[model samples]
Target: MLGRLNHVAIAVPDLEAASVIYRDTLGANLTQPQALPEHGVTVVFIDVGYTKIELLEPLGADSPIAAFLAKNPSGGMHHVCYEVPDIHAARDRLKKQGARILGDGEPKIGAHGKPVIFLHPKDFGGTLIELEQE
Candidate 1:
């Protein structure tokens, strides 16, 4: 059900600082900061050779990223996104196998303007998993 690796998300306390580290230090080309109010994050995407790295900052105090940063003030890896040909099918398969889906178990519009869903971390070895429709 999983396709190629999509972008890996990193929750950062400061998105600009994190973008600079990737842009100046690592010599990576990054996308402009995009505020996603629905998702409660402002994101910047760094383009690597094969995949991308997403830098996320909380849009508000109630943002999930804000909660994540409270636990690790320095910021850290947030989730790994994988592409799937059909998100609905993949979701149903995972659900039948007892995998927990985040939110209302419905696909949301992601950074790439594609349908995406997040799976519970505990079900996948303590690492949050994001499934994006290809």
Candidate 2:
């Protein structure tokens, strides 16, 4: 079962501006921006109760976030991350139930050193899902 609502990923076109919206407009605390060269994105986190919101802005063409935004221009929620004790067990459970995984292998490092994976929205009632073992 899920441990906690870890973070929600939002795909934004501008990381700084989006960070401001959450921090200034919404009054959420934000962390300094960080770049993940592997994923080609710059991200910031805003806490909301036990779960934090992750703002992701693509820094390159290969970024999956950019591709998501291209497909859904008015960029919205990218994924809902649920903290788990065992990501592999969660992955196996989802796969057996016919869930579509975006990546082929094990979980990869997501923002903040958390191991994460995406479950295709098509398989999750139109909501992209992320399982994080943090």
TM-score of each: 0.96, 0.89
Model 1 misplaced stretches (Cα beyond 4 Å): none
List clashing residue pairs in candidate 1: none
User: Model 2: which residue pairs collide?
Assistant: none
Expressed as tens digits, the lDDT of each residue in 1-134 for candidate 2 is 87888888889988877877888898888989988989888888887778888888888779878778888776688889898898888888888988788878588987758788888888778998888895
Candidate lDDT values, in order? 0.92, 0.83
Alpha-carbon shift of residue 6 in model 1 (angstroms):
0.7
Model 2: what TM-score?
0.89
Residue-wise lDDT of candidate 1 within 7-77, one digit each (tens)?
Answer: 89999999989988898898889999999998999999888856789999999667988888999899999
How many pairs of residues collide in each model?
0, 0
Candidate 2 residue 109 Cα shift, in angstroms, is 1.9
Model 1 local distance difference test score: 0.92
